[model samples]
Target: MVEISIVISLILIFDSYLLGKCISKYFNWNADYFPIITIGFFVILGIFEFFVFAFVKFQFSVYYILFVQYILLIIPIFVAIKVKVNLIPTQKELKMILGGALFTIIFAFLMGNQTLGEAAFDSNFYLSMVIENSTSPTLGTINGYTGNIENISTLHGYQGFYYFHSLLLKNIRNILSLNNTSLTPVYLWTSALTYFYMLSDILFHSINLFLEKKSLHTKIVALFFVLVFFTNYFNISFPFYGNTWKTLNIACNMLILYEFIKLNNKKSLFLLTFLNSSLIGFSSSGFFIACFIEISFFFYLIWKKEQNYTIYLEYWISCLSLLIFALLYFSGNYTKISILILAIYCLAGYTVYLTKRFDAIFWKKLLQFFKFIFLISVLLLVIVSYFVRNSMFSGSDSQFNGYSFFFRLNSLGDMTLNYFIPVNKIEFVRNCVFWFIIFINCFQGKYEKEYKFFLLLIIILFVNPFVTPFVVKYMTSIVYSRCFEIFINPFCLLIFYTGLIEWLEKNKNIEILFLLALEIGSIGIIVHNNISYYSKFFIPQKGYNPVYRVTNDQWELYQNLIEELQSSKLERPLILNQDIAVKAYVSNIRVLIDANTSRSAPAYSDENIDAPSDWLNIFYVRDYYGQHIWKQDPDYSKICDAIIDSNCDYVIMDKEVVVLKGDLYLPLWFDARGCSEVIYDNDRYVLLRVRK
Candidate 1:
């Protein structure tokens, strides 16, 4: 398993660099930009793969996707080689890259066992995805998760793009002849390593942004800050640690923001558009980020008089095409919608491109008119949203009820901001001092305009003052809150650091040693607070580590169950009560009632659960079917009836469960004796074959 993980990591590094080089060649960017660009290109490729395989039916072999991906890579490799792009790094750059790589390794070793805290279930879902996609790649449909449940509609829309990454990981595992159970650990390790790499990469670039002198001493000091800042892991945003995709979105957006700030010509605009669209494809929250980026860039260009309007129009059209195509494809359609959208966008883009040499005044007037129309449209939308805010409450989680739009927005903002910002009186004083320095430097700072514009953008978007009613009416608050973490909060931190670093560099008295000491001292305080904070929140589970996702006992039981099922020669066995862990670890198993949504098991879906009330209770409650109620012993007779009704071939249960019958509790195996034949039994788990 360790060898396979190392192999996968090497492959990831190589493929990302190659892809980044291939894509970056168009923009003429050097190898310094590869790490962040690599992540964006990889995600873009995965999303493109989804479009390419739109026609493929569910249950198709993962080998098909693998074959297509390699073929895709080969084309780019050929072009890149023919173009003779430089792949070498200078000594300084090499050191920075190695430092980042080393940080990834050490961070993974220290943090791999840690769960996602409240969101730990998401990791299980990801594991289930890797396991399921390792066999059959489903295009966002629930059919892959549900066994014997067929013709179910799609539940997850654009999220299908997210699964392709998991499929790619598992495909590599299969190529290396690794056991399926190795996927959980490999995934956890790779995610942790990759998450750390992103932070290190972000830190490397961000420090370079502020540092005019790239001396070895300055570099070492910056590296020291990275170590200190990240070691206190809880000081960072939770999504950065807990969710890989969300982290990718944050990185991509940050890169896009930086690119927009450097917006100069056609190439940069094209790169920004590519990154922006790719981010939108990966995360729905990215839509708002894209709007902010593109709009901000549009105005920035106008303000700077760069006259790249034609390219901006083309970029806008491309984004529109992508959004429309994704909407159509994930709407459960396998038709010509993609083709139609592409053609429409192509024609629109061509028309815009032809006007590049048109009179400047005419183009300016046209842009102004478009701006007027857009502003009016936004105004009307905001007004209309106020009347429709009540609609969001219907069929939604009751927890969101009774809170005003601004209250909900502020609450969500506080949740994400709390990770980095302190609320203590000491922190307030420290912030006041820091802000005082930043305020004095603002008048003559090298990046004053850029940093202030970013701050203003954050205020407008973060507070979302004008759009609160509209946001509440249309979008989920939790989902919208991610915008704060992914863009707003990060930008706030970036502005703070960029200003402070610039201020420090201007002051000769503040040597590298002083800066390093300040960073260490500040981070030490934060680390102390984190130890206290996390000790209360992160309770260790039995048989589980802070670094690993699965418990040793659960892994052993799943591995044993897989071996037994294989030895028994059950082909694509439909399983009941297997849960996400079993569905993920045991290859070739189809679940009948996942008891969870089809985020992991795309085969079995709950989207079609519309039975009458009594039947709903039978399957959802009384029978303990179609639900995962932890520690609640199921009624054996009802479970048997459910297995029969659902036509499940096998049923799995914890051997420790004691079924409740009237006034007495009895061992599950004893009560379930006549229901099924025991095929596999162990201290932790029991697998039974339903007697049809």
Candidate 2:
């Protein structure tokens, strides 16, 4: 796993450099967003750097320390590109990131992964902190700490993308906990650190917006406003606080992209490429789709304004680097999505070449080849889309509450934004406004051709909804793939917008007003969400509400159960489907399976309540019919017995599985004679042993 991880890390470094160059070439830095971004990255570097040195000194693991150090070395230097001056101090921006980390710490101590302190959509994230450094990284809620079997891989959109983040977090967390046995501090630190990364993203870029060196106090205050206002807005105004991973990552990528464009240095490009890849890896399957969009748009810009097609080498390097990570990702769909990504970028470049010049018969035939492939792709897409629409809905993989075609068709406006300013919507409006303003102003000049494309792109996008609805249903069906669809084109539009905004137009202020109105509209939609969502925090609601979470009582119960099992003297008989498996790390007992592995089991799946009876026949539990399956240490007669095979210690029957729904792990006697012994029993769970 470490070998694979190291390879992945290397690829991420490579992609980060290349993708940053491709994107930076097409995007212009906007002052409004860059200042805070600048401070955010610098602070991230300093703090993470401090932690690395401190950790290495404590552990003496030079190599591990260096990997963490790379984060600081790579990320902050990119941020520094936005810092033009040599005299100004960045102490204030660093403090804000620290202060934000402090605030995050306060919440970390009070919160665990359980529902008690758990926020909506924000799972405890402590597991991520714990196992980022662990050797065997698994997915789902149940870890060695909680013996419950959990299939975490399924919960987070795609397993491939999810595992990448999991491994990194576990590896990091373990590095922190190498000597100290206590986990709470580890928990507190990881949580706080991630928040620091968040602040780094915003503050570092925002600080870059200042043309001249501003007061340390001024930069500090501005960074604070960006973080607090945005944090509050997201928690209150958008549902994204729970679901979206791209919010911070995209900002960081854009900052790197902008920095590269401003500096145009190989070092800058390398920084952009690496971080952009990580941000994409942060939500791989989702962001893979986004990168595809960006790569395509990038070439369109290049083809429109480049020296030659030889520049295509850069795109290949970045995409190839991205493909390495994508291959490591666990889903088939994500791998397949790369095809569309390639096609999009390739097609865009060809379109630009054809539109820009008339190169007679030679060019026309080449164009025909591109056109043929494009038509075939569209045909294939339409056919697949027709079927996809028939099965549209989120949670399809979850067995939770997956929707079919009918439900999606019923939900039009509610699907994308809920009239609320979701991060996805924020992107949509920002890009749309950019298109409207930039195109209208550039009636002539360099942007004229691109301007026309923007108008056509808008018409196609709006028309896409109408056309897709009849076939593909939901606009957001791709799942977690919300940002890339719009961000790439907007980058192109804004590149034009920025150039046009600074241009000496006849009615520049009027265009600015038009753009401002769009920005305000997007903000307004998001703010209204805050007003309505105000009821969720401070005063909690029931479990059914989207905002409603597990009650405090339930959390206390879950924790106490964990503690009780720790104290019990059952000889730590390999527990299956419970927390005891990983928590076994501290407790002197060994558990078999975990909720991390079991929750995703087919038996409890909403879609497939697979037969647990099969397990009785397929393993050591064989010859153990309905009654015998619940017997003490399940009887394995012949190793080659027709029915039983897999080796497992014990099964944890809990509220997690409806098949284990009855208060007990099934009655002892099939023929009425009591056959099994009860080891542990509770309102929420019960443990049984197979008898000899």
Q: Best candidate, TM-score-wise?
A: 1
- What TM-score fits each model? 0.76, 0.49
- lDDT, candidate 2, 1-692, per-residue tens: 22333343344333332323333333442333443332233233323323322332233343454465456446534544553323222565445445544644443332222121122222233333233323332223333334333443322322222333334445454555432232322333332334333444354544545312544533443333233223332222222122233445455555444443344432434343344444443344334443533454343433344333333334344444354334434234475666665665577557545544545565556546644554554465456556555455445432212223222322122212221223454434544554564455556455434544533433233224333433234333344224322332222323443444444335766645654554456556444333323224323433311111234333333344345454555544444333322332232223443333332332333443333443332222121233232223232232123111223333444333221225645432221113334455555444544443
Candidate 1 lDDT score relative to the true structure: 0.52
> What global local distance difference test value does model 2 have?
0.37
TM-score of 2: 0.49
lDDT (Cα, 0-100) at 184 in candidate 2:
26
- For residue 171, give model 1's deviation from the true position in Å: 3.8
Across residues 103-149, which tens digit of lDDT does each residue of candidate 1 receive? 77766655644544432233344455455555555434334344332
Question: Best by lDDT, which number?
Answer: 1
Evaluate residue 344 in candidate 2 and report its C-alpha lDDT on the 0 to 100 scale. Answer: 58
